[model samples]
Target: MKNKLLLLMCILVFTTGCKKDFLVQEPLASFSDQDFWTSEASVRAFAMGYYKERFPGFGVNDVGGVFSIRETLNDDYASVSLPGFPSQPTVSGGGWATYFSDIRKDNIFVDRVSGMGMKLGDSATYKHWVGIARFFRAMDYCDFVFDYGDVPYYNRPLTDYDTALFRPRDPATFVLDKVLEDYTYAAQNVKLDDPGTGPRGLVITRDVVDAFMSRQLLYAGTKLKYDPATSAADRVKAGVYLQAAKDAAARLISSGRYAVADNYQKLCSTIDIGATPAVNKEMILYRRYNTGEVTHAIASGNNVNTIQGNGAPKDLVDAYLCTNGMPIKTTAGVNPAYLGDQTAANQLANRDPRLTNTFRTDRFYLQYIETGYSVTGYKCYKFLDEPTQNEAYAVQSFNITDAPIIRFGEVLLNYIEAAAELADMGTYTVVQSDLDKTINVLRKRAGYTAASRLPDMKIIGNLPAVGATVYDDADRDPSVPSLIWEIRRERRLELVYEGFRENDLKRWRKINYYNTQLYPKKNLGAWITKSSVTKALILADINGNVTSPSNTATGSGYLKVSQTFRNATSGFVVDRNYLLCVPTYQIDFYGRNGSTLTQNPGW
Candidate 1:
């Protein structure tokens, strides 16, 4: 009887295993599936891992460095490679690999969540987690489609023994459909406001999802490939998605959850490293960074003397409308003398205050005075962190600032553009009230006393002539309306240093307009000196009041120094080769599986 009881006990133990609840496991190596996904905390941790997979370094050649790609694609930023500059790729290998890796991790998380059974917690938590997963999946796919075009769709992770390791590329439309499906799911299931978290604009709130949807739809609607041969229904579908995006943005604006920061200086001045809360309302979605964890060394030029020297190009500087809401040409044409002076004080004077926030002018000084770095022509002021510096590289110190991925301001603009595009289809000319709200909000942030009325066709036709009289109409393409062009121009100016211009140029098919041969010819002017006697004296004062003799002498001498000359625009013509080709290694890998992915034409 005793032996029988012992056997029975052993059987029971074998059937119902002992619970392992407190085990810590290292990721990316090996772990038991049953041991991992058993609780809400575990699931949340897995989601964080997905986010970690997507985070790139802050180095100049990393994704943070890609921030300059937009500047390069536009006529706004230029680069001079020296020691420590990472190998420059014809296409961004780091960006490509990081995004693809992000997709892989997101796929793994989605698969894991689907199979796991939740029993202990609220069902809503599980649903919210799933919604967040889908949101990330859609975001990763959107990045891939926009940058690399249609890529292989891997909704699940591959097994080691699976012979189908390689896959064929899907159509861009198919990928877009996947993005829409995920976003739609996220919008429907995710709570508008997560419980206990309050209405934090920094997190993945319902509004952000909607804004992303609008961005995606607008991108699809404008692409020429989505026309007739692709499908008659695509255009209509595009309109629908865009409309949904617009509605979502309008809802957020109405909800009063966010407002543009009060002043242009506030936008730039909020780079304080010691602040208790690093994020501001102006930031929608941003990656948080701390000192020693990651750094923007290359972009900040190793923080040499707190001067990164990553300067913005003159063409972008000229893009900002004068403070009077008139084109630069309106002012420049009236006084050619001001045309040669691109100093922050000269070029930015009487212009949109956003210009000063985005680009450093001679008038603005670095918070650290000893560096004496002034804007040579126009320089980027958006990413500088003057308060924090790595002691080793005084200029290279990594500030604990958050890098914003999306902003509400962008959503407003997206809504206005999309609604205007769809106006005739549903609403006549998209309501002027909606357009005004978007523009006026941004103008207010820039300290504009009042908003201007939308320009009519005749007013647009009279936009100051750029390049030659032949190109005047080119600048004022009435098919899209002059007001729309103005909005786009504002976006170019406001979003200059952020990583959007390159993709924006591709999507709009307007690379030819800015990247023409006439760019160099049109921009022949001497570099504007950014020195002033008062600023020089201030720079010399190490103790905040007493001027250093050396600095005072340099400041006095600089007033007499001749202005330096530098060509602010490139001569490169936008040809078929403007888009990057698939790297040879990727093509080689895909070719083994009987899949032939063609390179971009002329590449």
Candidate 2:
């Protein structure tokens, strides 16, 4: 590699010769901005930058920092947030414009790609690069819509004369419409068969755009229906967007290209997302990592020695169904076995295979290093330390597993959730046929071939599946409709650590999940007991936590409330915290002449 720097100096002489003084310098090894956009190759080159900055896959260069493993902020599993705390930031605090800046990059690309004095391409040319730019533009707004409610929407590229940059924030509904437009264009024009980016060019595709659109539409539609931000008239159209989400998912399904892989555990395990992406067709868009060139530290974090005991709590573990396709604790047969089984191993064995695959059970715990990583007592075995990187001689931070961005399974959940909501609103009826293509497929994939996982799909043969089964959980919050709650539960179970929970809670407006009044207080862990021979690794910290021996011991050791997560937040303040505060500069810049970027409600 070689480096070159070129500086252009226009020296204006104060003398008589000043009129002729000018700079005529050629840029060395750099494309001139004035001419760069004239060619298709150059325009495509510009779009590649967007992928590097925002397209999340395996840690491009940073290990263990893969994008989808962002569950620390969610409720499914509790882990300490350091450098950044494990909980929500203060109301006055903001995430800065790095995200906004990334959005701006997309804005500029879309403006230039569409504005460059020529059609993106001829009739024969599908303008694939332009479609990519539009896809990214939509994604940027989607992130903005979720993070900071209403944001200043941009279309034209930024310039010194740009006055809109100083305009007030647009309504979230308006921004969502624009996002939908871009996604729609990407879905229509991005050549479905043109292939995508990364080494395998497997990252983005027209189908991937639709899958993400499905998630965003579901999120936006659900929030509009549940949140008070919309008017009664606006609320009436909730089913429209909800149906759009289902439609996007339906398009992907009818295509027959994406589906859940038979083996769910290995999707993110030792086989590696990059090597088995074809096998794991569920992942619509993913980040690929090269072994030495672009590695991440997920392997280091998964190592038993450095693994920070980020275990799945009992609350999540019990959500898994028994092999018989029934909720483990709901039926007397399985629930009793779970409650009576003295050892943790025996209890785990009685539950769903996903539960065992996601966490370290009895026999599996024997391999835990002396240094305990599972702070929750029940350690997470979800994204396992791959055999290639977990070796004694390997660098833990150098693992090369691809990280998921959007998966087909997520689209399936989005489909059913939207369908159920639409049915409740009387906009559409979700019949058994929808279940056959969506939920039942995942059920069969999870190895419940012998039994139907969700009996509602099985038993509602001729009955109206929508209103037939009423979920009457006394423990469930009254604000949540039973059907919606069940849909949320299925989503929670299917996409646990892949980082869907925090947003799920936000969209459903169930901030009370963090409200101590409703749930067991924060920092609670699984039950354990002393003198129980569960695993050899149980001896590691089994004796130390036995400090309050006289208090009691139930299983392998004891449940220790985490101080790390406890001190992280005062609380996830309802309403205000549901959305993040807008980036400060956007507010300042757009706040000129009675124009405020507008802080999120309560912030």
Candidate 3:
């Protein structure tokens, strides 16, 4: 039997958020802590639960996760108040302990499946389930290292009398190496398609393992390469992880299992979005939200007529390439069709098609569900389905649009970035073929025509060019290479508002990108004609000075709410802010156990 009931069990648990640690998690009770290996079906059900735990999709009712959530901590969003950056440690743990709960489950599953009733070592089914469990354990550790730098590593479920439960933190390099090993096992051993339903694109498969591995390995590689705290010997291992990431992505590309098959808008806002070949063509793995079964508030939050009290900032908006496939701020003035940013229409004119697809062009002025408005003049509709925006079905907690967990689109990006970082590390040179396979494919899918496709990103001597002329963005950070800078810009535009900017900036060791003093555009919003809009507008310049439109002058300026909100805030303290501080409770708990948990530097 295919055990279709497992899917229903999976959907019912969709509302359970990711718990922070193994210490607090209750072991599976219904399936039994004993005889857990009685059948493959039960094992499969246990694995399915990890999906809901780690991948929250669009999240529970009225609370957003993964999709279209406000990533205001990064440069992409601007609102009335600047999102607070991590400045100090909390006496209570900051969710750092929640990962272990799942980690413990992973450990128990692996331990039992191998040593207990399912000791069939060579069986493909046995390998598949164990591989899935370990893959999740790696994912848990990836999240751990990414946030807390160094953390205690565990490979088995601990008992109350276990002395190893009080083990000290392992070096990040050591921990990440273990993560790499687990992902490698999953990638090599997991089945290519679900044994239950072949190529359904909704279950754990070898492709999903490789895709996630590429993302995590790239993060591991970049953190080691960029973080100043990394030891010299550990930094040498960065190239190894980068090479592995590139290899993993290359495997998926060569396998021909997926493609950039759907258009930008269709891929993002569809209902019942997985299972069908047409919809799952681009998605390697996705969470399907059935109406009245498992629903989320992401679409409702992005409703055009709803008051979404946040917006894409000018910093992100300006990153969009002009229609002519050049930056709007090029030194040579290449894109003549580029209208100035005095108003929403003018700003969007002749820009990249993604800009129009992402932000609601017509709703830039205003509309209503009992008087709705965007905090910034620009409103994001990337996740909004226009047909359902005004319906009862699209309101809070009732939205049924599917959430893409891992798609071919993100893997393509991961491939290009890892390849570029490897090139920068002097491991190898990036050729034009690399760009064609990765970045160019994404551009073509983003509404570009054969005649007007973005000029292929050139590597050797030439940076990104339009037609025959090479140009540089006027606002690019001088520390970055022009070629690398252009690649980063493409990533910024392609993945905006998808909760990637903060991590992207961190991995590149460019957290200062959010510092208002360095990039004032972070605090600026969409340009508007102050007199034409009905709302009382507060406009300000980069210096935090409130400027009133002169009586003789046409009232016009950008919304500056974030400028006032962030006026006195110190943004992105480089030394202490890259990694989060280990909560005081964690340290105290270790001390009480007669073990010491060292805090991150400068906390």
CA lDDT, every model vs. true structure: 0.53, 0.61, 0.75
Report the error of model 2 at residue 576, Å: 0.8
Candidate No. with top TM-score: 3
lDDT tens string, model 3, 242-310?
Answer: 888988999999888787854677666788665445556888887778776788888887775678667
User: Best candidate, lDDT-wise?
Assistant: 3
Model 1 earns a TM-score of 0.71
Which portions of model 3 miss their true places by more than 4 Å? Answer: 1-32, 117-122, 197-199, 275-278, 366-370, 446-453, 532-535, 541-545, 549-554, 563-574
Q: Model 1 RMSD to the real structure? A: 10.2
* TM-score quality measure for candidate 2: 0.83
In candidate 1, list every pair of residues with a backbone clash: 76-313, 303-395, 303-396, 306-395, 323-350, 323-351, 344-361, 389-397, 390-397
Q: Point out the higher-scoring one by lDDT: 1 or 2.
A: 2
* Residue 217 lDDT (model 1): 64
Off by over 4 Å in 2: 1-19, 23-30, 60-69, 79-96, 116-121, 124-126, 195-201, 270-278, 331-341, 363-370, 392-394, 446-456, 459-475, 531-558, 563-569, 583-594
